[model samples]
Target: MAFNFFKKKDKDTSKKQDRYKELTVKEVIKATKDAIVIEFEKPDWEFTYTAGQFITLITDIEGESVRRAYSLCTSPLVDEYPAVSVKRVENGKMSNFLNDNTKAGDTFKVLEPMGKFTTEVDAEKKRHLIMFAGGSGITPMMGISKSILHAENDSIISLIYANRNLESVIFKKELDDLQDKFEGRMHIIHVLDDAPLNWQGESGLLNEEMLKKIFDRIPSWGHENTQYLMCGPEGMMKNVEQMLESLSIPKDNVYKESFVQGTIDKAQKETTEGSGQDYEVTVLFDDEEHVFTVPADKSILETALDKDIDLPFSCQSGLCTACRGKLLSGTMHLDEDEGLSDSEREEGYVLTCVGHPTSPGVKIQIG
Candidate 1:
């Protein structure tokens, strides 16, 4: 949740991060009807990764270069080779292709792991982990639950996994195995909107009442210090956060991450009328400089990519710092700044994905 497991480093790593490498696929296991588990051959060279972080997969979609990030579903402690889960979506071009067309022996340019939705394992103190997942959001939660169980000596996990029905649930067999292995330590509650008749588990969408009932039945383990971690569609995440607030849980112990920008409303795009002036933007990336003109209404990353300039970025929703860079000159405004730390902004760093030029001649240094 709010904890981390980073070791002391001799030097700064951010400047050396965000590199990409090609890895061969080892195998593909069908986790469910709509989801597939992709396993990669562990690289001979060093490429260590955390459990809940995601890697950007670069591919060609109908002659167009495209990049999409998928969370690593396999636990680093449990699996030898890194693996990720992909669920087919109706219009998700990359997801459908990966789930249906990709196979063993295939190769992909996978960027190094990057993300902040993580917690450390502490064997000294008992840990209580509470997780909420909806649909495909179960991918990261699976890794987190397994990592904690495998690495920590004193910890218990409680999972509230929601899906349309039994058939749509991903990782059913794997989760069942974990439950069997952990026994009383692992408690899983399934919430299905549609199910067979006489199903004993909870049914219907998850609400405040349903969550309370599930928690009431959960085993006791340091309730005052429990950690709540969540990832899902925007609306479900909001409801869970509200419920946590009502319970008077400390905000510091709660954590969340969204793969897409679901919280932003349609009205947010319709900003108040401004001067409507075009601004001059200069971006520096990969030791190269590109100068262009971007409308004040458009984001710097959008304008740069439109002009055929490649800049490192993932999760355009501003939840990841991949597109982060130093502001060299001029002024810009960010629609959202959750990923960027206060000290980072104070040091003139910005997430160009959501940063728009507020004045002319803005200079950005994208390392």
Candidate 2:
């Protein structure tokens, strides 16, 4: 069986079968001019989640169903209600619709929380977490910071967040409150692209020089006791990765969450090069076997959804591993494999959303 990380150990097995839930919006608070935080009422059934997981919100707009995934900003170990912060993006249908129309009494259909960018909390462990966030990417980091601080007495967090300007900083007051409450345990450094005249914080692109200065200010926990995390625009993350490499930071100690699919170009390969023909793929999920023909033009998950065969999926761009399945037989070509770690790829784990059958008799098993 596929490993089920989202399942509650004490809950009945029947409840684990549910893939979606209807959650009533308890409140909506304006986090910034372009962002709003939506809080959901606790359901009668048990709804549990890890700190860094995200929920896919589904709604109808202009007679068309739309879905978008947003990371939960409320921690299961700290907060009373689960919340997600949505920031408006250019030409983002779901984001704009929610920001403009969603209210406290509205109810939404949401997929259960799912993600891999999480850490297991241990009270006995003493560690330091260094996080870099840009714009709305701070959502998951907020939950993670709260969880770590509340659960581990000796663990500390250092956050370096960047935004367009002071007015656009999401969760400003909330972050200040956390800093004040945790005092020496939590440290935050804010960087802005456009700063006011009297601004005392950083105001520039996060270049190598800026990172060096920032590193000098933060606590110097040895690499063995420190873990680095980043979530933000592709450009910023690339820059940070380059700087970390220059600083001799090991790649294994750094992790990142991508909200958008990367645009880095890869060498082109023929879609049917291996198979030399259209292929029929078999997917075993939910105790049923689904057989379908997948054309070179469409992904496996896209074909399944077209046939009303609902296999699990979110962020079809392949940044989220919600449609991951273990390949039991045959070969597949992936347009993007950023969601899967190197070990997972070696273990035959494939993401159906960006996967195309590249050989005959392809078989996959999904939970």
Which candidate gets the maximum TM-score versus the true structure? 2
Cα lDDT tens digits, model 1, 189-263, are 999989789889999878877877877887665547699988877777888898889878787778887777645
Off by over 4 Å in 1: 1-18, 220-224, 265-268, 272-274, 338-349
Q: State each candidate's clash count.
A: 0, 0
lDDT of 2 at 88: 97
Using all chains and alpha carbons, the TM-scores for the candidates as numbered come to: 0.88, 0.93
Q: Candidate 2: where are CA atoms >4 Å away?
A: 1-17, 264-266, 269-276
Model 2: per-residue Cα lDDT over 1-367, one tens digit each = 1122222345343533478788899999999999999999998768889999999998999998788899999899999999999999999999999999999889988888999889999999999999999999999999999999999999999999999999999999989999999999999999999999999999998776787789888897899999999999888898789888988998889999999997624543353434446688889876666788887778899888888777888899888898999999999888888999989999999999988888888999997
Best prediction by lDDT: 2
Shift in Å, residue 286, candidate 2? 1.0
Scored by Cα lDDT, where does model 2 land? 0.88
